[model samples]
Target: MSLLSKIAEIEAEMARTQKNKATNYHLGLLKAKLAKLKQQLISGSSGKGGGGGTDGFDVTKTGDARVGLVGFPSVGKSTLLNKLTGTYSEVAAYEFTTLTCVPGVFKYKGAKIQLLDLPGIIEGAKDGKGRGRQVIGVARTCSLILIVLDVMKPLTHKRIIEKEVEGFGIRLNKKPPNITITKKDKGGIIITTTQPLKKIDDETIKSICHEYRISNAQIQIRCQATADDLIDVIEGNRVYVPCIYVLNKIDQITIEELDILSKCPHYVPISAHHEWNLDGLIEKIWQYLDLVRIYTKPKGQIPDYNAPVILKSAETRVEHFCLRIHKTLLAQFKHALVWGKSVKHNPQKVGKEHVLQDEDVVQIIKR
Candidate 1:
């Protein structure tokens, strides 16, 4: 489902739940946000929840944005989710270990982005890699897909996974996936019989960046960078997808790997087992994604001056947001008074069909 539609769904649900929870402060705030969301939906601006024109790629009604993690088994995709969200997904060192999508929430920048661990996608998985056909289901629901690579095989591994998603009809622009290096603290750690780390050239990292459409805007190519600026640059480039890098097994890699690691963007040298970069990973993740929230209040007399504001991703009529507060309030709905924002749309008394905007605190004077 589109993100905006999901947000609309949330609004409707919140409105229904408001009846018994009228005094709940959070519910009131959620209702105010729902008011904004309903307006967004009515105006057909539910494309990408980003606050802008009607020209969004694809926005669902709900703030529930899905970031799907897909890769062949043993690439440590599940382990990434576990480290990031504390999800208890089974991680085995074998082929096709994950057979379905395991969903968990990962917050970036005060926004909740749903993370899904899809089964090990194979070459023909798009055509239903054994039972991997559910990718279509996952794609249909998720807002973005994070293509995880073990960094061992480098580009070769990512290429295969890309093909599967395309075949399954998951159309995405060069949307940059949070392309994680996974086991950072494992410098001396052992997982498989992979070769010892070796120095990878600019062209190689660039190739991976190109595959993910990440732009290398800064950094000196010839000289070496032991500092963390290069890493921040890469993490900053992640406006749309997974925004950080988890440098798996840093303690185990050769000097060549360490040299490369220092320059990578948002690289957190951590081992999931050893729990090294876990906090940094979380902080980076929160810093990288976009989230839209709406703050709302019930259809009561007035709201507190400092009540929490709900954020809605779409354009919803104020009345619609009110409906979220009470189906009956929408029925006995009168005009609304908006208290926030620069623009003034004085409560031009109407029915329970008013639309709202960001920071527009409301007082839904009902019948």
Candidate 2:
């Protein structure tokens, strides 16, 4: 059967479990996961060659913007989710506390984004330990992944975390994941960052080098003042959606560690339970989500902001929306009345060739 069908099967089982008194975290995770799977299938990525893109799943079609929190257990993925969405995920001082996926929604300037806190994964997570296939599947389904790291001493966990993330990326269609260095407490000088240096041991580095050959993309970054999210955003990488990195538990990081973190790009320091700079995090994420509020009205009616208006990308056109509404609209489409300055849709009678702009209301007249 097609991958879509397979995803449907899983979704059906999940629905049953959810109705049969399943846990909210698990139900939420399964539902969100099914949504992602359906999206990939709709975009034609369900082909046999597995997912095809470095940015998690390869969606050749219009896909939702999904942000996932990824890290080993106790690194604060759940805590961050709790703080960001008020989900009240069980937080503890140990590993493997989060056994299931937790999904929550966050709003930034009227745009709602899906935030996922996946179960904690460890070394060889993709190989079978700790439900590796499931966890890897969760991360693989995301459009973007937020890697969290503890900015503490020893540097062993840091290296392990980075290595594991990169390694897992390699295993899943050679996708390149965004990194987030999370710091807990304060003590050391400052962390330093340099362009991501390939550790030779990291297969992602080798795979990326082999794939791109000459193109250069840095990997590592130290937390800094200007850093509020992932390196792709901090370094001005042309990204489809914006990403933010939270260095949780800033109270645990030392000044010396801060010096090291400052080497790459500066990230935001936050305490998940204390509401420290949480709004800043929300604003930054909202800005990157590319959310637009569009108003809609039928015929000669006043634009109703409360109406269910379709939200799409800034560049999405009327024809694109037409297909979404109905495939036959593309063929039977006549002229449409446009409000606001959509450039393509604003003027007199426009055909399917019209492109839509943010907040532009439209009325289509077809035979």
Candidate 3:
């Protein structure tokens, strides 16, 4: 049997199985097995090598961040791409208009964001059906996913798209579960937790470990997690990414429908064809990207506001900023004077370890 077929069988069995005290261990084992099989599918254990860049769908990543437009066909994705980035992607009233990945640049707030218009994905995408795997594979490398939806179509399409993305090991708008596992040679499975785990028990963990052939390991759980989250850690290929639901074609909907959609979490309703609410979409993208911009000033000179060095929020240290400019800057740097939200006093001198904040002004003094 094929791996996908085996996965389908396991899923069917899992669906029929009852989830109770007596069946938790069994369900955990099944999930572990299913996860293993999906890994095989992605790795191309069947000799096809999975969905590599052979399909020409994976484009070169550029700019500060990449946002992929994903949805079913005729969902105004191409129209939005054209309006947002001023790039031409073929739009049609038919299904499957976009055949490959179309690249565009979205310049916003002095940040050059790469916008990727990917081909429409169908059901059973994770199973290598219709270019869905290739489309989703490209999405995995993006910093953010713009799940475009048609307001005229049924909202159920959102759930289907989400399921397909999840099947490919992409966790949308979620953080990695607070769980860690360490392998040891002699120590038996030692489970520890900072707080009570309500979703999983010791028996289920043991069963999952045994299924994965992990005899000795240290397990730590810090928050509520399910069997799937545990399996995600064990399998280790999952990507947790933030997503925005872009409900397109709001011009056709009534004001009541627009109000309803506005209340939904992480969603922005817009009419791509009419070019309505495009600024709102761009602003939301900027907020979700969590990027920091630092303006550079020479000694005894004003800060350059025209061009700014952009960095991720996590790595905004003085050393990181130097490394971003040039590798040699780190060795030549003595100290940096910062004037902005990152510093208490204006133009305060700081070291390499000093953290930087958004819109901070920096001046590096050479050693």
User: TM-scores for all candidates?
Assistant: 0.48, 0.55, 0.96
Per-residue lDDT of candidate 3, residues 268-340 (tens digit) = 9998888899999999999999999999998777889988999999899999999989999998998999999
- Identify the candidate with maximal lDDT: 3
Candidate 1 structure, TM-score to reference: 0.48
Give the Cα lDDT of each candidate: 0.50, 0.54, 0.89
lDDT of 2 by residue, 58-138 (tens): 222222456777777787888889877777678899888876667777755445567777777687643334544455555
Give the per-residue lDDT digits (tens) of candidate 1, residues 117-225: 7777667554333544555445546655555555555457656765555433344443433223333332321222123212333443444333334453332333232
Superposed on all Cα atoms, model 1 deviates from the true structure by an RMSD in Å of: 22.8
2 or 3, which is superior by TM-score? 3
Per-model root-mean-square deviation over C-alphas? 22.8, 17.9, 1.8
Which numbered prediction scores highest in TM-score against the true structure? 3
Model 2 poorest ten-residue lDDT run = 225-234
